[model samples]
Target: MRATLIPHVPETHVYPEAISVEFEREGGLLWLRFIIDDNPDFIAWPGDAPVGRADELWKHTCFEAFVTTDDGYREFNLSPSGQWASYRFDGYREGMRPADEVCVVEGLDGGRDYVALEGRIELPVEPRRLGLSAVIETVDGARTYWALAHPSDKPDFHHPDSFVLDLP
Candidate 1:
């Protein structure tokens, strides 16, 4: 399924005119593509780096996914720099440990008007619900949060209500 992400709040001007995610889940593997549209200028994209586990990727421009599990949920962070992070959360924001599966950043491609990253995840089971989101950092060091749904006024992707998409 594919869905467009919206900013958490109303804004007159933002560097990225739009953001979207396309994903497909089959059994335990998920393929995802994050796209930034409309002349992605002033966006601080990470340069190419070795693919490895990273911490606090959310602190910069990153694509993220929250998948539901029986006892808790899993969080996947994919960066354009080829870095990725996965964590198993016991609950809303509890028990965060490295997830069993390490997600892979397949590719990062873009041009003057757009940017995109392809990633894959091997989950223990198919996710029934997912919260797709992204943190976009600008040239001036400003950040904007984008998600399929924002349950609160602030950008809190860990909130349960943010998992608004149900896989079919």
Candidate 2:
């Protein structure tokens, strides 16, 4: 399914004007695609170097997915720099650990006015809920958080309330 992401708050204005996230399951692999409308001043990681298991990618431009089943959830971060990482939480933000078993392949497309990022991963099983979000950094170093829903006063993707999308 495809979900259009909106800013957590209306006052936080940034580009691109529209952001959409699409996810689908094919056998055991989960496919993800992010489309960002053209925004001239959007900041993207310049280098295309291979991004190996990195921590705290949310500090920069990154696409994230929070998948939950029962009391636990899995957080996946895919950056424009070709780096990706997944962490499993026992509940909320508890028991965080690297999900090394889950391999991911990600790519970026920014040649045109708009940009697109595609990612695929092998999931252990289908998740009950999915919270999709993106952190966009601009030329001026301003950051905007986009997600399906934001229940907190501040940008908090880790909150269970942010997981608004129910999966079949």
Candidate 3:
């Protein structure tokens, strides 16, 4: 499945024309491909680093996925800096703890006008709904939140209504 993300507010610059996330389920693994289109000069990306787990990657340019399970939900933060974070929530923003499960990330790479992230998130269960989003920070220290759906007036990815992607 592939979906485009919209910025919370009207875009003032032409840094990025669009952002999207793709998911493919195969061999008990759910693969994620996030693409940021028309990132002029690639100024928003923080550059590459050693691939590993880290915290608060969302503070900068990053990609995120929220998968709802039987009991709770999972949040995966994939950063362009080669860091990733996975957390499990018992409820809507409740009991957030590091999932500690490692995901296979190929590292964030980009071209002249686009950036992409590819990774394999372990499928804990068959997700029925999903919230795919991103936090983009430009070289000028400006930030914009993007998501598949913005149900609230503000950028609230945890809102139940934000999980607009229904799976079969």
lDDT of 3 by residue, 1-168 (tens): 888999887666645789888888775567889888885564577666677888878888888888888878888888867778889888999999988456777776787887788987765565768788988888888888899888889999888888888653
Better of 1 and 3 by lDDT: 1
Name the runs in model 2 displaced over 4 angstroms.
Answer: 46-48
Clashing pairs in 2: none
Candidate 1 segments whose C-alpha is farther than 4 A from its true place: none
The true-versus-predicted C-alpha distance at residue 5 of model 1, in Å, is 0.5
- Give one digit per residue, the lDDT tens place, for model 2 in 83-168: 88898888978999987436465677765676888997555454788889999878778788999988889999999999998753
TM per candidate comes to 0.94, 0.89, 0.89
Flag regions of model 3 displaced more than 4 Å. Answer: 12-14, 40-42, 47-50
What is the alpha-carbon lDDT for the whole of candidate 3? Answer: 0.80
Clash count for candidate 2 is: 0
Candidate 3: RMSD to truth: 1.9
User: With candidate 2 superimposed using the best TM-score fit, by how many Å does residue 129's alpha carbon deviate from the native?
Assistant: 0.9
Question: Tens digit of lDDT per residue, candidate 1, span 57-109?
Answer: 99899999989978899999999888999999888899999998889898778
* Residue pairs with clashing backbones, model 1: none
